[model samples]
Target: MSDPQHSNGWRRFWHRGTWWKALLLVVGYWLVYQLIGLGTSALFHDVIDVADPLSSPASIFFGVALPILLSGLLLIVLAASLGWARGLFRRESLPGRRWMWLAVLLVLIPIVLRLIGTRWSAYAVATVLAILALGLCVGFAEELLTRGFVVNILRSGGYGERAVLVLSASYFAIMHAGNALQGQPLSTVLGTVVYTFGFGALMYLSLRVTGRLVWAILLHAATDPTTILATGGIDAHNAATAGTSGLIGVAGIFSFVYVAFALVAIFLVTNRTKVAPVAPATSD
Candidate 1:
């Protein structure tokens, strides 16, 4: 016979429901991320010699990579503890052909354009490796937390797919506000948030079409290093204050492209028709 104590524990757990679980997950991840950031700043303040934390390679490694790695691991552990690990990697069936192509275009076009127009530099091999590692960690942590965990939990909580997509994207975009604390100009930070909102939407559509996180993660990983290399590394102060007019112009153009693509993706995903069940054969 089942123990009454075990039964009571199970019942209490279910009583929390998906809404509470999602809220807890979001808040918990945010707190963990902030704590790591604070702790790292305290530990590394005297050790690192960089003037700006955002642009420094060592600072990026410690500030961005360490926190992201720890928070991401914690998120995964929490998800597993809550019995949601099995579905974390599950992919939906292939989306319609047109939507599939659109998804591909969404992921590829920006990356290709950025790669082509941006100039490559001759940074030391070690620096390049470190930047790549930073990119990988950012992609993995952000995607897992926002797209993987948050999206799945919301869906399970009876939220519509469209709502889930928008929510996840918005959250991803807003999280960039932390960049402001790193010394990026207010205008630059705002522009980035807008661009990222659109990027986040595209990532959502990519997951829907591919039914997996690998493509999303790869695209994300590629995007960061490409931007940094192309733009000549992360210079928050210069990007914000120096050549302000030119920066605004470039940001405007990029923002327009991102918003346009994001709208198209949203339309396609929302309007997609469900496959109808086939009628059974009738023997006369």
Candidate 2:
């Protein structure tokens, strides 16, 4: 019979390696995102740089939209190029009916939030629509990279389901560290990371239960920009916060509330149904 200690040691070995692997993935992707930013800056050099973050429509549009779009496509391309391409980008990989429900949830959640004690000005309405579209645009890329590619990479390398879920979630959080550049407090940034990690877990569970990336992606995309739109268009911090709000200010309150709602949704969906775990591979 196999020694129990030996089996435990082997499991620990993979677990430790998986954490390190996740660290590397986070670091590597940060570099890739930075490069994309630099490239986009060079490519879109002609856009006027408004003096104020809140006033600059171009900056707001670019900030909210570009990262969402690039992160998704970059991961898909990187996955395909690196030989880990698993048809994640294809429509067939998504759960149809479940995803449709999720899409409705995604769209409705924001609309409902906007209607609740929310003031609607002409510019705010326009901003809401623009922000919603921006969220959807980038949602695909973020989910592809964080939930889709990262999980698959970990699984193929002999990690367990729990390990893959945690690692990928952590990776998602770290990648958003750049939010600090926008004047986000360390606490808010850290909270955002943790909250997003939970989101990542929910996405992973959804994918396993449904065997489709669509619902998870749609759910992931909706909560964020929707909350932002409901509150108001991107704030100074969002447009690149210039160090105004402290640890628990207006933006912080808004962010905390948003994250809380996301957690509630996760609790609801997960408790309502059991997610099937992806089977461990015979060979990797």
Candidate 3:
């Protein structure tokens, strides 16, 4: 059982990644996801409520779950085609530290805050289950796309650790700007962009510190449902209005910390220890 990334199959044709390909894939993923959402919404519009997608099972299923799941399936297919399906799961893609525990803790704290604020008793079990399924899909899909593939691609392209950190997180965060096209208010859209940028860095840290992509996926998965359920809406538009109490008041604190961590981490991300992996050569 050798590393499949080095296999003679896909590697022969795939060659290697460039920085532009990373951007292209990110844009392509956004397009596919948005198209899927549009397609599903049109197909299920009569059955699914157009209002409050987070709280409604049918809406969440037809809108968020089905669209993202389909898009995620496409990503998986692409990963397999690129010979990355198996290699993407391997650990220690970047260096780690004990201090990174703070990074992990900051990331986890918001989930706790949101959990306390969730009125779990208010929603039907089906709705709650739908939200969970949505989270799982989101976690796997987003993490696999950004941290899994993009990070590897950046490294393979000979980018330094800092550039990889910045680009991957930026690609993950900036894609949220699409909310504006979806008709979100300027304030809400800006807020989401800011929040997701920080969230993206924290997710990157989650991958780095744990040296495993799974932790990033799980944290992202946990964060989405909790935020959705607690806020009674997605993407913090309702964050200010939805949910109350002590810890929830402390919400968005992690965003500041994550951004700060990213800022400071840039200076520290100078470790050039990883040997950039090239496309495996074939014998003539």
lDDT of 3 at 20: 81
Q: Candidate 2 lDDT (Cα, whole model)?
A: 0.54
Per-residue lDDT value at 272 in model 1: 28
Candidate 1 local lDDT, residue 144: 82
- Which pairs clash in model 3? none
Clashes of 1: 0
Ranking by lDDT: 3, 1, 2
lDDT of each: 0.64, 0.54, 0.77
Tens-digit lDDT string for candidate 3 (1-284): 65554665566334466678787888899999998888998999876777767657888888789988998899878866665666787776456767777778987888988888777777789998999999999999989888887887888877877788788888887778888998889888887777777778777777888988889999999988887777777765464446665656586567677787877877776657364443332332
Model 1 regions lying over 4 Å from their true place: 1-24, 54-57, 93-97, 181-183, 235-254, 271-284
List TM-score per model, in order. 0.76, 0.64, 0.89
Error of 2 at 116 (Å): 4.1
Residue 82 accuracy (lDDT) in model 2: 43
Worst 10 residues of 2 by lDDT: 272-281
Better of 1 and 3 by lDDT: 3
Backbone N/Cα/C clashes per model: 0, 4, 0
The CA root-mean-square deviation of candidate 1, after full C-alpha superposition on the true structure, stands at 7.5
Q: After superposition, how far is residue 182 of candidate 2 from its true place, in Å?
A: 4.6
Question: Which candidate ranks first by TM-score, i.e. highest?
Answer: 3
**How does candidate 1 fare on TM-score?**
0.76
